[model samples]
Target: MTLVLVRKLLRDVRWGLFAVCLLLFVFSAFWVKIAQRVTTEIAPFFNGVAAVSKINPKLFDEVIFKGPGKVSQAVLGGAEIRFDRPDDFLSVELLHPVVVIVTALWAVSRSSGAVAGEIDRGTMELLLSQPIPRNRLILAHLIVDAVTIPALVLSIVAGTQLGLALIGPFEVDYSVLQKLDLPPMVRLPAGPPVLEVHAARQWYAVVNLAALVFALSGTTMLVSALGRNRWRAVAAAGLIVIGMFVANVIGQLWDSAAFVRPVTVFYYYQPQKIWLKENWTVDLGEAWAGGSPMVEIPVMPVLIGVGAIGYLLALRVFDRRDLPAPL
Candidate 1:
């Protein structure tokens, strides 16, 4: 059963999707570099002021702020750069939706053919004739889908890291490095440390990513099981994912309204707080001034847990349903 499942999954690992993810990683890397350069330039000025009592260059470098003024001033010189903030380590947080969209597409594509497509293509009868039980078959497909989620995520993280390493600034002050106890071998072209995380923020991002992935994969699987055709299943999943994104944007733009906040999965994913402030301690007040109130929400865990239970229910549904007539 495991071998069958592995074989089935390997067959569906589309090169096109991999290529798209690679492209996104490249773009995300460049964006990271731009943000780093802007922040580093302004970071020195604040460091210099703080160093009035002690003129150590490292002192300025070690100081972390919370807002985007310094980086923003360095880049645009008082002009607003839309969502771009001065304090952000990598502007990548602003582009997180791109990540979600790409991963969601990959998830939908993997599951779209799990059930309905097999029936439509006349392979369902052949599988049903085998020794495997229907529940086992459903479980196999679910396992394959779950494994693929992490595989794709790692790819994105690798691609983004490599991209940033190549194009971003490489040299940082040894004193700042010493203060942080970062290894001398570590380097970037023009940014802070590559793998930075605040204890609180890192935990937040992990929870957020896990929840988002589970929710997305489960929803896609359920749709695949419920739809009458592969195309329909994929379409349904895509719409739902896109709808979540749209709802999140609406909620942010109009914070007072309660309607959009409840529906959007994005309302729960707060990378700025998790990655920027909680992980790296990049000085949000000096670098980027606004507080993300979404971090205060208690509903994030509930939403994520609910989505997971929903996916388990989907697995049950897939196992019980009889295959449609062979095409």
Candidate 2:
């Protein structure tokens, strides 16, 4: 019976699942081409410098991308963020707020219908007439959520990888290396880093994305459990996502509102940092250097805690609430 219920939930969200995958497919198809074109154009600029100098391509890339006012640096210099870097590229692509909200909206749609939707359709009364306990019904929804959300997120990643494969492997232009003017003092990289593949470097994104969607699902489930109808549940969830997202953006860009970070779920959801395998702190000494000091935080605990709490709270509310009175 539990398995059947799970299948039913899967059927309910099948179109949503398809829509997510389709969107990712379309985005990746275009993203890969754009990345390649940018790389090709930049390769020549560096190659011109390499021709006259013995500087390595890697060192030159670092200077231009990590240099002052380069890819992500400000006028005086700050974060040496390079979007061209494989790790940053993939991490930013799918972990964007747009992706999060779309996934959340889908979760809300499915979750909102968990009870209120059934009520609207006049199915709740019939389902409750059976021997299934209220907890089992809720558990079935939770169980299905666990199975579905991650699959949806993974589809985006898979589509990205597939799209990249069609374009070509990412590499520095050898021609740029030929004609590049570089400083003699620039030391050659000992060898390729232990992890060179973008996929390898960004593996943490999978875990982070899964946790993120689950966090959204937790809130979504709670709202659905409490709502009088599916539409109301969706509205409630949409507002929560929007409010939290706005708080997240303000906290990110405005030091004055930094306090909001701890309160918003998006604060802990740092896919880019996680993919890079390190986080940055403002470089106290480099006040003029425009670089952030690196720091590390435990990733799993906070997200897991938030998700667990929301689900538990929802379960308590759901179990205690009266069933939908027949229309």
Candidate topping lDDT: 2
What tens digits encode model 2's per-residue C-alpha lDDT throughout 76-102? 112444434554455556544456767
Local error of candidate 1 at 221, Å? Answer: 0.9
- How well does model 1 score by local distance difference test? 0.56
Compared with the true structure, all predictions reach lDDT values of 0.56, 0.64
The Cα error of candidate 1 at residue 131, in Å, is 1.5
List candidate 1 segments past 4 Å from native. 14-17, 40-87, 167-207, 279-307
lDDT by residue (51-78, candidate 1, tens digit) is: 4334654433234211443332322211
Best by TM-score: 2
